[model samples]
Target chain A: MASQTRQWLLTNPPVADIKLSGDDATFSLVTKELPPVGPNQALVKTLYLSNDPAQRTWIQKDQDPERLYLPPVQKDTPMKAFGICEVVQSEAENLKKGDLVLTEANWTEYSVQDAAALRPVQPDPEHGIKPTHFLGSLGFTGMTAYWGLVDVVRTTASDTVVVSGAAGATGSMVVQIAKHLVGCKRIIGIAGSDEKCRWVESLGADTCINYKSKSFKEDLIKATEGYVEVYYDNVGGEILDLMLTRMKRHGRIAACGAISNYNNGNEKQISNWNEVIFNRIEIRGLIVLDAMPKMGEIMETLSKGVKDGKIKMTEESETIVKSKFEDIPSTWMMLFQGGNQGKLITQLV
Target chain B: MASQTRQWLLTNPPVADIKLSGDDATFSLVTKELPPVGPNQALVKTLYLSNDPAQRTWIQKDQDPERLYLPPVQKDTPMKAFGICEVVQSEAENLKKGDLVLTEANWTEYSVQDAAALRPVQPDPEHGIKPTHFLGSLGFTGMTAYWGLVDVVRTTASDTVVVSGAAGATGSMVVQIAKHLVGCKRIIGIAGSDEKCRWVESLGADTCINYKSKSFKEDLIKATEGYVEVYYDNVGGEILDLMLTRMKRHGRIAACGAISNYNNGNEKQISNWNEVIFNRIEIRGLIVLDAMPKMGEIMETLSKGVKDGKIKMTEESETIVKSKFEDIPSTWMMLFQGGNQGKLITQLV
Candidate 1:
């Protein structure tokens, strides 16, 4: 029997606030017939979709095409999504039918993508890592934390690191790597809720501050003992400003993401450049693509770490909100409000 | 007859505003008998004193003593000053009487310092470098410009550069070095007045913006043609914010000084961290001492550049407000208000 495919297209991009009722005109759901796989192509059935803060920036309008590191999402196009998939049919020599893979299949039930775009995700059954773990702990999010902390900031065991968005996917891994793997002297986590703070502490953070609380500033000063040597910033805004105030001389900041300001047209004003100058801080914007060439070695090390119990990842057991394929838009919106914990993903059969 | 030494002490530190009338009690003048030079010490007569923006930071009442790269100024001690001097008495084999030197000699007519602290300033008469030029373009100020532009920022001829405080001592040298010596594609200067702008243009800046002008923002946007690859900032405040808006991806900034926000307790808030993140800008604070190990090679190159007419310095014929030894307080006050130009100094004979 011929296969049927379903896809969602961004009809109207969200400008101010993101809505996710499935009734909103933000996305249009449509059913269609699956096309045949051509030469060097594979028919991929989406399994697990990944949602990230960068999605907000990819939808921003009036961007300088030259400045944007990623291509902007266009209206009427299938919104881009990264996910784990199962190859249903293939006309390529490198991939065979029934092979598990990772690729950008968009918000689609089934996608006919070039075989070159898919990465084989054959997890060692002996190691007991789920295929979806390939999308979270062993994928781009894990690499983001690795390259940011180890390659970019070059954090040392003696350094005190402050991780903003500490409860989020990339930030949670950063906290663990800084504490358990890198042996940082102290790790402080800045998150939004009391529960998130507790989760961050469980990930081995020395202390976690709920930024939503009124006493966060006083608490941060007391927690870090008035000194911070490395700041792993994933949420850039006022919290980044506060971090700047207590940075030690020659402090290094790994500018990984700006999730806090991504949804508001990125107009958040930071008013602590004086501190950056006086403290001799170095804030380097991190684009994971720059570290892609070295990923094979990084992934090998990460896989070994998982087997050795050196890298303890929280995404496997906590906070992953499971949803149906039809709920992609709603699941994505949860990322903006921190409603989705761990890595936000939608599973499709 | 024994020689008497005169010096100025910070009897009452300036907390709010700096006044120089000698009656404000911020400084006290006293005369005392000169002590004999000890072994390895040289008794030097002060010539030309360098008034810098960093001096204002040294006297702050509440400073993290460990963070300060330099020792803070104490209430009863002589104010720290760098100047050209003539070694009158030398007990160390490295120095001799009447030899010209450059060293830190407080606000004093005579200073007995370790001979190792003084670097010989033997400019070949054929080079036509005046004795006072050592305090301006050949001393620490020149080294500041050299390390910041060439070593730290590593600017190339293909880059467009913007310099704030382009008419001042270190800044003017940076402008000349980027344009004339480094061969940058375009050099734009941001200064306080139209006259200073013209002076900066004459110093080889492709264009100059009078930051005090009402149309400064529009003028800056128009001048750069919507792109700036390097920013050599000396006056860090709103000007730094303006530069942030125009910086290109992977832009480099050499944070040399914050003269604009140095006085009045450095309260000027910077609101441009967002730009620093999106543009992938690297702002590095330049502490000249960190570059001291390379001084021999750098000083040699700068001296050769001056001799070969490759480094066209502007201080040869500019506003250098020279005063007597007792006028150090008043001369320093000129720096905050922009009352003096070129290099503000006290010529003590």
Candidate 2:
């Protein structure tokens, strides 16, 4: 029997709100024969894929490579998805069959990728790190959180930190890190729903506000008391704009992800620019991959934190949607709402 | 002799653009009896008042003390004007008669103020320094330029710096400092007219574009080529918004003043916030007064720079309009246009 491959291809980049299906679908499901593994290449079967909020921005229309840190996903190609894959066949010296590795498995059932691109993952759990954790706390999601709060914002016991998207994947990690590990004086979380806020608070946030509430701006103001020393911003739009006015002089902002503005792109909605000057605040944007050289260092701290029970384990925070390849787009959309509060990932076996 | 003081009072703050005198006047000329000097106070006659673009923001309406670096000017008060003043009478041990001091002389011919608020200016010229040079180079105007370029953005020889309001007082200083002092390889300036651009270029800026011209944005794009390493922003809003996109990785911006939005208050204009993150840029706002502890040190370098001809001598750059105290408001409005292409001051005697 001829081997088969199933993958989702980005057919068009969205102009405004994203479309995953129908006539205006940004992505399409395609079936083809699995390509044979060539020199320095490995054939792999994707087990789990990251359904990232930033993934939508990666497929933005007319993405000027100059503007975007990562180039726009090429139209009519497999939509970029970084995931854990099991090596089915290998022609590279470093890899063998049945070995699980982390690479761009994408939204595909089987992929032939450069062996150099793959990093070998222990097939078995090491100190409670599951292979799916590579898509969760042990991966870029965790790395982003660690970098944003610890390295970027440099939160301390003296700081009053406010984190937007407190319930999402990277955000969830940041909340736990700032509160449980870093021991910040106050860690305020901004989430979409009251339940999500509650969950975020349980993770270690001092107080969490529902941004969708009628009195969100008022509540956030009251919560922060106009003394936000450090702001780890995950959702970029109105919340980020409001936070600008509330920051203390010389405040540090870790511009993580603008999840809310992922579709339209965060535009001219910000009004408190004068505050950025008045307060002498610093806003720094980061691509977590830029810190790949620090990966060993990050993993050491993150792994130790997890092992020491300072940071929550994958099973505690993991929110996975076991869905088919056809449902990847819809599954990705579901996480946008506050309903999916924990570390979001798609179990794409 | 019972003397009368001629002064300008901020009667109302503007809603949009400023109105100096009209049915909706923001300022009014008034004459009052000069109050007696009290203990720890000095009576002074204003010699020269700074016609600053930022002076307008100090008079902005409903300014929250929390939002503004300096408190807003209270309505029905002598409008704030920092200037060179002749000490006519003194009750403080630190001040004496005939001494010239740099202080809040207001838009008044004569006024009594706290002696501690005044810094005694040298009565005689030293190293070619004049009383007017205190307002030009040794004052807060020049201190703002030095702190912004040397400390805030920390521009190096390799930097491509863009300065807005390139013909204005602080901007003119920045153009000279970034070029002759810092020796930055390329410095582009944005002014409001062809004449002002030429003046800015003459002040050591590599090229100066007329922001009012039809090809302004295009010319700016072609000039910087999306590699603005450091931006000394004297004018904010659209130019700053555009610069957010044009920044290189880890670009730095020194937010000295936003003169263009001084009346409008730089609202809802910034759209390229994502670029602030994508490029890992850092923007810092400065209130030059915040660095007052370093004043003696700043004056030392500025004085030396002038003496060595590295920075322009006061006579070479001072744009003094000999006018009555009542003309302070109108003269200030004139500086907003690019015509006043030097260190602006109203020579009030």
Candidate 3:
């Protein structure tokens, strides 16, 4: 193993105008010697880094440190991320050298993580599922989609579902699950561009509407004529407002994220508060951590679905925007800009 | 039997400035001959009419006709209200003459309603609980409080419950139940005035804050030091927004009414929506009709509680704003103006 390890450290928080300069003060790439793995810990080499919008929220300077859902990434510390990793050295019985695992070990070429914090990736060659699926489809994002749809929104085949941020990592899983697995008759995806909309349509969504198009409202209204029963909201703000207007009585909204408000000082506001009350809608703000107790069962079902070919997970590596370790700072910005089509993966090795 | 009957009719819908003029175009008092009872129907006399905030929402001229929870009162027709009534004549086996009952019959001195729609009142002379308990503590408002608090908010003894519109009919019941029955650790009531705040305190709330006071924010913070675990919201607006800030992680909000939005074109927008996401809050909009299937059992439990003296319902009839039959139009206005203390009732007979 190399004696020197390189990691991206959060230096300063990003402002409203979130752009990375060549020598961006927000993040710094530094090389240091790998720390010795202690007992119950393993040294991991990150294979694929997962890019999530939640990364932006974690680095907010003004957020109350005590109230954050998870601890914020401290200044001059390696930013926390979920990634597919290979155990390079181990002192724990659960993990061994060359064993692939999923962990909060990324933005780094090498990491020393507690073995207990890692989840082993189940290799199912019969299904042709890659180990990276554990970072996206069969992982936290999939767990979020499953619980949000089945448990929170209580989706049924008879219902018409609407999903915002439909081409993104988490939202795309929700769109496919609602359509194919849950058997929802009509699944509509609201995305930003026609290219993203096309990607969502290719994943078996009934229809995709580009929210940026001039005919967005008309197209959405025409597409969801029966009204939305379940709205899996990955992007909140105006898209959520539009969905609120088109919701039927007793509609359920799974508030997954408000990516639109992440970098903007002027947070997107939802004005259709009346529709929620008048229609007796239930809006639940979900954090995947709340669904952790059901992880074992969730992973089992997800694995079976992938193996049985009941769940369609895009495996074309070309879809995952690959970047070198040095490009981590600029590449992370792609999450906010919607420049990354599928999951954005940074390959270290 | 009396051949003539006096009833209140809705003449026109109210405007942004919702006021009932003495001879208001919104309501008319008319004398009409009682219609004959049909099969499975009973001719009932309205003993006490319920003046609920929902009445204001039901009569909104701009509301979609199909979206009303219950059928809206037609122009020149008897305004619908819940009431404690006496069955004067019945063609149905379940109802008989002189049977004290609960009904969706009000504003009118007499109504011909389906027997199935009436819930017979349980008179407990032993506990000195009157049949009027059916309209307040044992009625739809009571059911709304019960389900909203117990079922929806899932209050526990460990919870710090805060209620808005604390002295209003439905809110008072919620305040009492969350404090007394559920035994929440800290119970705070948010009311509009000191007098209303005092009334809420008398019902065993740990503290009461007058939202109209300049020290409202400081007082609320001091009262709920541990933060609000469950918020039963009856008046939605700035008060709702204020509560959003003080909510703990996984806090539940039972949205029973948004009375503040009824009169103004400006609907209350919750600006601290990020708190909901970060704290993982769940806000459920409730309409009592959704709990109809649990009505029989809900009324039974409430009636028994009143009879057993386990539930303390303030029976100072003076606190109940009672008006003569012709004052129905003016009496309804008392609801919006916070003119009623315990419950607003119109005595038609």
Best by lDDT: 2
lDDT of 1 by residue, B274-348 (tens): 566666777787788877899889888888888888766445423455678777788777777765556667776
Clashing pairs in 2: A285-B277
In candidate 1 the C-alpha lDDT for residue A158 amounts to 95
- Find the candidate with the highest TM-score and give its number: 2
Each predicted complex: what DockQ? 0.30, 0.65, 0.34
Alpha-carbon runs more than 4 Å astray in model 2? A123-128, A314-316, B91-96, B123-128, B314-316
How accurate locally, in lDDT, is each candidate? Answer: 0.80, 0.83, 0.80
Candidate 1 versus truth, CA RMSD in Å, comes to 4.4
Which wins on TM-score, candidate 1 or candidate 2?
A: 2
| lDDT of each residue in B82-175, candidate 2, tens digit only | 8999889889998888899999888888888899899888833566778887887778888999988988888899999999988888888999
True contacts kept of each: 0.32, 0.77, 0.44
Candidate 3: Cα lDDT at A278: 69
